[model samples]
Target: MTRPPLAVIAGTGFYDLEALEDRVEESIDTRWGPARVTRGSWHGLPVVFLTRHGPGHSVPPHLVNYRANIRALADLGCEDVLAVNVTGSIDPGLVPGDLLCLDDFLDLTRQRPLTFFDGSGPEGVVHVDVTTPYHPALRRELLEAAVAAGHPLRDGGVYAAFEGPRFETAAEIRLARLAGGDVAGMTGVPEVVLAREAGLRYAAVALVVNPCTGVGDSEEPITMEDIEAVLATSREAVLAVLDELVHTRATFTEEGTG
Candidate 1:
């Protein structure tokens, strides 16, 4: 049987993958709803790309249809998912443009569909283990690829997912930091949870776009203009890491060593 394509799910400032070739947009229907994706290839390997926010970044993190997006990727025969999340540094040492491979997450999202198995289907009331929320092998590959691309990612970090269309408060950032969150973002929770439920090997690369509300000496409020400035310069580094990863995967597949 042919192997499923590798999937990449990205949020904010990442609308498309410039490296993806032969791209075709596809709208997939799921029990949850519908999701739009671009099917293409990278380094001669099949890939499925999904942007969490809709065109022009119209969708906010709190309003994203996580179920539909996860279901769509699963239906598309995607076995491995590589995700990118733009985050603010909760760890004082981190700066804008720094990248980290996430190993754990604290889901602080209050209201979102958290699962696919609602006991409505044959599976019924399923509880998936999240001891190792991020897949080990995939995380390793990402770290290795980042190094290969000269954009080394910090090996591990904890991601805190907040419910937001707005930036977090200083107190909220402090709370997350106390809980060992290294970075904070809006859209990592149920998506990662749902990916595990779907049996897809998932991993995420976090790009630090700014210091969270109270981190560092800056008391300045977070602004999109500053965040966009970081993304403008940092996006290519994330893409470079991904490019190397796809090239490595393609090589391993050709050599039958994957």
Candidate 2:
């Protein structure tokens, strides 16, 4: 069977790629660790899906094996990756259910391993240019897909990634906004950075599930129930975008080959 050329990294409640056809599980081993990946077909194009938070959504952001996940996808011949992140809007303009194609990121994570280049790896102490963190070509395709799907999508935004099992406090949200972040989430940083280090084209479609701690008029504090409720309602939008993304990947590959 032909290996998949594109991979999707799913987050939060979205652990499986529902749009994929003829799916099969493949376990991939890398120097860092092993990642179990799902290989499948979408619209006759090969695709791979990896649940960033695992199948049962048991892994926390801080504990996710970012390096292993990126390495596994790269090893599977995936040249491009589309990462879906569920985020909270730091800017009022970015409302719940808005899809944001992130252009930049601010890493607020404290203890996760961020790079593939250890002293023993292929390149020692090498730096990859992150001036434009998300791949421009992929970003364009994502925006076009959003338009075709008739979804509310922002062309670009800055995502701030924090270390978390807990949601950010209002003070922290304000601080992130001051730091030039448009959206706030826990999982976008090391994954995007790791993909770049693995030499794969990457872009993130961030689904804003709620207003960040201080952005909207809420009588009470943000809770797990509230977040889950918003996510449940916005789940359809996420699925719609994924369908568009799969089609976009097919188009991109066909054009590249032709």
Candidate 3:
């Protein structure tokens, strides 16, 4: 059996993976739009790395072309996607720099292209089932890898996706918490949804950058500087987990036992 390359999507402070060798940048054109990605190999496994925010973080959350990104990855023969999202903690106990493998989500976005199926395609109107939005096997692998790497990762978390370039308000965070949200982010929605629509195994690991408004004792407002500082410190830890996961996969493939 042939294994497809792993697709990794990330935003905010993760511009490139230094461990990736022989990198080649490409612009993939899809029906929705053009998406940029880097092709490389990591730990003897092919990888497709995409920065959702574009180079230099030029694109904002609400403006991301979710359909194009997802389509491009699918078109490139990627069967599994690993997403890393920087988020604010809605759970009061989750402090900054905590990592969680998200199991569910609440979409609060008002506007954006949410699907590839518009009833125009030959498949007609399609409503893909998201009973398990994040692929269970992939999530398990991530958790195991994190543990093996000696990094503590919360197994299950609910990610609340809000439409924004702006941070959420206290009332909004409270509402999300009421709905069982553990973390809040701006870009996890349609991306995850589209991956499901495309028949790709998808999972996400969220890095908590700060506490959402009114969640913790910090009355201070969220700032880019604060988020960046945490990202800078925690990026290595996140990458280590990914490395462990991919290395394990490579080893299993070599042994013909995965």
Candidate 4:
């Protein structure tokens, strides 16, 4: 009955962690709101797992309550938060099925709430530094785990976050690359920022689900079918990395990047 100090925040289609022992649902309340989190143990290590998109993939990206999720984990004493993002490949080399440990990000989301401080924080005018938004030590630990688990993981990439229930346009894809984005995804921005502000060591591993609006093998426009197919093919890779990370805790330290 020991509580796991690690938190894994993944997408909906990826559900490998459901197999954890003694898994139970818990309602976590935060200053922003409440978040539903799953508590479980893997290899005797406690893990708190939650999907960025809710069960059955019903929740849209822009609608995700990033603050509540991060706050809930922080309140639960989770020190390391690992986010598994499904991204569109902007780099040709980072094609579908490839896993990349993100090093940076570009926020193009205009509609989502970007911070936890809006005169409602514990301290007034709280300024959290995000010079290195993603924690390096944690990323290195995940990269090592991915390789050890037999998954070929790219060491680094920049994930661009788009405000979307809808996918980005081809023109936007072009703009993403110009802005130094290696891949694009709907989630990853506010979640990451919130985690940093919450004092949790955060890292993300991206599974390239498809090309951005116009960067893949197909000359035709990207569709839901294409992404679905990519996801189907990537299910195993996703399962492997996640299982390995949880079982081993990916060699992450509780001290974090402080």
Residue-wise lDDT of candidate 4 within 1-258, one digit each (tens)? 344478989884665466578999888988789898999876667788988777778789999999999999999889999888988888877777888899899999998988988777568778888888889999887887787789888888999999987888989989999999999999998999999988899999898878887786578776778778888888678667767876665234332322
Q: List the residue pairs that clash in candidate 2.
A: none
Against the true structure, candidate 1 reaches a TM-score of: 0.97
Best by lDDT: 3
TM-score of each predicted structure versus truth = 0.97, 0.93, 0.98, 0.91
Comparing 1 with 4 on TM-score, the higher-scoring candidate is 1
| Model 1 steric clash pairs | none
Candidate 2 C-alpha lDDT tens digits along 1-258: 343577889888787877789999988888988898999899779888999888788888899999999999988889989889999999988877888899999998899999998778657888889988899998997888888888878889999999997889889989999999999999998999988888899998898888988797874676767778888888788678768877776677777777
RMSD of each: 1.4, 2.2, 1.3, 3.6
Stretches > 4 Å off in candidate 3: none
